[model samples]
Target: MNRRDVLAAGLLLPAILGADTGQERSTFRIGLTPVFLDDQVEFLKRWRQYLERRLEAPVQFVQRASYREVTELVLHGELDVAWLCGYPYALNADRLRLLAVPLVEGRPLYRSYILVWDEDLTSRSLTDLEGRIFAFSDPLSNSGHLFPQYVLSMLDLRPEEFFRRTFFTWSHRHVVEAVAVGLAQAGAVDGFVWEMLNRLHPEITRRTRVIERSPEFAFPPLVTSIHLAPDRYALLARVFLGMHADAQGRDLLTELGLSGFAKGDRSDYDEILFMAEELQRA
Candidate 1:
């Protein structure tokens, strides 16, 4: 029930161990990909350590090399709980169930923005990005691709037709750097990631200006297998929602740049689903 209990259950380690531990030990593996690894690894490791103790299972935090690898990890039943981007969740909604959502500054919403390399520019809107060398975080990224592309499609434009070149930087920090370093004219990236990068690595974010803000959307999601037992899933949900109320748990939440965790449901992802369907029909 407490975070210290989670750590004792071994939930903080990697998912490299066999299924014997996961099944027999009453534990499951959870993780996000490498995008937040640099800033949030400590928090993830600590959360895993805490959950292992609580569930009395050997808990592990799986490290994914890329977004595609992360999706496969969930599809193959290797990851029990994944903090994932919206686009992947939208496509795999049939296989995953929403669990909890991280709140940034007390809101469970995040946004994406078109960022240019000038702070004083008054006309760097999304329309201005046309025919420009644009960078995205990844094909599967929610803020970096899906949502932004969705917006573009709404305006009767396609990425390939709208941009002279498009590149997937694979990380929000990289997107910031790409525009700042003049490698790309503009990019769409997670607002939270941009803020975190700016705070932790200002030299990169300072050079980029937010030219446009996309509609607010749900933040990264925490989900589990559709096959997971409902009772245990409910328990998992309760534990996460109550986490930030604890001492050490609060510290870990801060480490992850979260105000707290809140109970969420599939309904919160409906917008992403609509976007995916539109993209598919296009």
Candidate 2:
């Protein structure tokens, strides 16, 4: 599996949310979830290039359609690294390695917003969408699907058993746009992505309002192939965790709107693993 296969494969799955890192290889190819259009993705390529210069290696930014594809890339060794959501990380933890991740507003967590069209009739709880069409950012998204579904299960309601229909928007911005455009009655989106989108395209995202927010979640983290050497993995992690203190690295963080990078561990994804397992058994 290479870059082409990664993008060719549709990736609609549950994913954990949170973070990025400075992990690198001599000639690394990495993937980012296709939440951004091409132009916005090009803007992110600069971050990979900056890390390349510091690591003294060439880095290729692989364009991928889904977090599941990114996870598959790492697992298959087609991609040396990835910045994937948390649920996907848990799903493929056996084939991946954690490098480093972002710390936002001094924490390593991110949030998910349960959203609805401004024109939607009164409803305050998750169950309000029951028997109605619902949209999720991606199948692998934490709050978007995994946690939200997990919440529904906690309430003795399953999405497939409750909602009339459920669709995957594939991107956080799409979740906002879908609900706003009335393509979906309601959905879950990354809280940070919602803020970013609203800031970037106010008229569009503003048409929708957040009806609820899930408990705080860890943002996507930079993960690598399980095959990567421990020394290289440690070096990669160090470069990222130290980014906030370095001039060029700090600039990259500023561009991504992240405060800095931080150390992370497997404990970071325990809940993701738990929910995934719970869902499978049900």
Best by lDDT: 1
Off by over 4 Å in 1: 1-27, 39-41, 119-122
| C-alpha TM-scores of all predictions | 0.85, 0.85
Candidate 2, 65-165: lDDT as tens digits: 77777788788888767889999888877778888777877888888788889887697867788887789888888877887898888888888888889
True-vs-predicted CA distance for residue 84, candidate 1, Å = 0.9
Each model's lDDT: 0.81, 0.79
RMSD of 2: 10.6
lDDT string for model 1 (136-228, tens) is 998888889887788888898999999999998888878888999889988989888888787778888889999888888888888887877
For candidate 1, the lDDT comes to 0.81
Please give the range of 10 consecutive residues that has the lowest summed lDDT in model 1: 13-22
